[model samples]
Target: MHSNRRINVDPAKIHCYIRELDRSLLRLAKSSTSIKSLTFIDSELKRVEQCIVRAARESGNLVASRFGGILEISSKGSKTGKDLVTDVDRASQNLIANIMSETCPGHVLLGEEDPPDKKQEASDWMWIVDPIDGTTNYVNSSNIYAISIAALYKGETVAAAIWIPWPNDDGFELMHARKGHGTWIGDSKLHVHPENETGVPATGILSSFPRWMPKAFNINKQLMENQGEIRNGGSACYEQFMVAKGSMQYAITGVASTWDFAAGILLINEAGGKVMRLNSDGLFENFNGWAENYKPDPQTYERLRKWRGLILSGPPRTVDFVAANLSLKQPRLFTRIKMLFNN
Candidate 1:
């Protein structure tokens, strides 16, 4: 039987624990030297990248095959009842999980749909997956949905793969990256557009912001005035893919979970871009990495699942420019008092 007891491994000792694991399969350096550790990590990440790319491709095909078919959909029990899950989403995740079990067995698998019950399985590495990222778009027969898969080592994303549908039913495009390796689409490496002389896009650039944020904040207007144009492709992963390829300048998402951006964050970072998130100070701060406060316990999955925040990602200069121009609306007196009391 799988134990429910928490395994409290100190974050600082995680590397030591990893070194003691099956070294032949993991290829982790047994040495304490930082150089050797980094080298081993890179080598392992390369293997992880290959595994996830295959998983993403298979899941993508599964999603595409059911794109227009009748799907059994249900609400995720959100307040608005708009958040949805479908049969295809569960099937896609199952397929990805099966592939991971074969290629990288014993690693923890976390998916947007039904996470694993064995929290003790989360050892040194965990796979974060979003089998169908744009579920609403997929439900509506839109081609903007994507499959995202990423591997996190000691809470830091080390490898990622995102599969997006190609236009005209031309199969899918797989964008993948490993830490210290450049992001790639097929054989070509991706580089974000260079900062223009004005520290912005030369002409209007394709960009995205949450459609509903305009009602509560002026971020939409600020983006339009400073960034020139705006568009929301209904899929955060798709928008992030565009940014990684230099086709879009930036994208700002309202309240997103880890699975929504895990793969894209690494993709953008590897493509010479940056990601920022709205902090408690009401400022957009650079997102350095994930799992900074991770606890290796049964509750860790819940902590990650509950993780939600606003995100802005793009080329560093453009991201800074947009962050500078954006501001939140001041709360009303009652709202401020309520917030203070709640805090």
Candidate 2:
């Protein structure tokens, strides 16, 4: 009879308990802040860093617990019908939002699962979250997924954390960074491999849409032959983590949303890497200048929600070399017509 019995559990209560624990820890840490020399902005960023780290950890646990189990999956109605959203994704985002609400009240939340109107309220602080960065990977039982959380103050990403599953262990590791503080996995500060600067062959990640594959094939081929091994891990955040940790020399993604790469951008930048994006002029340009010119407003949040672009990131030298060799110019009208006819 005991073997046939089922145990009932309340996920809501458990989530509440976790939120309370996070709040208590935040309070305790704040009380111990004896340094009076820190600027107000710096102090706020430090607190946000602590909160985001805990939020990522808790959200990662939620995602890990559901892996390989029965998942309620749906599509985001994309043209390819391949953009998936699982129940775990919703649960993870909700858990993160709950924690942020309790710990950092009044901050605007820009989450993957939230509607655009949610950002209509203008606020100085914004939390950008991709609860499950690799939902498709998670659904397929791959461990390449990640939880990404970032805090933006005045339209600048100041504190960020990414929770990635450990390959050999059954646990997760959180990689976090503050704006001026170097990226960290625990106490060790992360720095991109200096070998990347020497242009030695090294592993790199490359991704593009299926339609663009033909055009990108030459670049991919050249990279493999001259730059080293080429891979696509399907998760932008995971690829960014690898680059930040010096495991990979660079990563280029043809399609990425703000939430998909916000935290990863900060992590890579903090790790002494560089990031560039494709511009309308058919060239890759430095991407770090946005924060310098950003003007915070409700409309800015709206624009961020709709933002999508090609991003290339890595050590400064490697990124420049890769960008210089890449040919992303759009096809001419005649060329497009000829390709359609050939197809």
Instruction: Give the number of the best model, judged by TM-score.
Output: 1
For candidate 1, report its TM-score: 0.82
lDDT of 1 by residue, 1-343 (tens): 8979988879868877676676744553445466777788788889989999999988888899999999999887756548789999999999999998999987888888874344543445889999998899999888888899989887778899999998645588899999889999989999887776555644566777877655545565445566646888878888888889988888887577778888888999999999998776667898855667676665666666656767898889888887877667766622442332110
Name the TM-score of candidate 2: 0.79
lDDT of all the models against the reference?
0.80, 0.78
List pairs with backbone clashes in candidate 2: none
Worst 10-residue lDDT window for candidate 1 reads 334-343
Q: Give TM per candidate.
A: 0.82, 0.79
Best by lDDT: 1
Task: Write the residue-wise lDDT of candidate 2 on 1-343 in tens digits.
Answer: 3577688989999999999999999987886673443566678788989999999999888888888999998888665448889889999999999999999999988888886447465467888889898888988999998899988877778899999999646487899999998999998899975654455346443322224544543465555456655677788888888888888877776566778778988999999999887665556788752354455676677777776767788888878877777674346733442332210
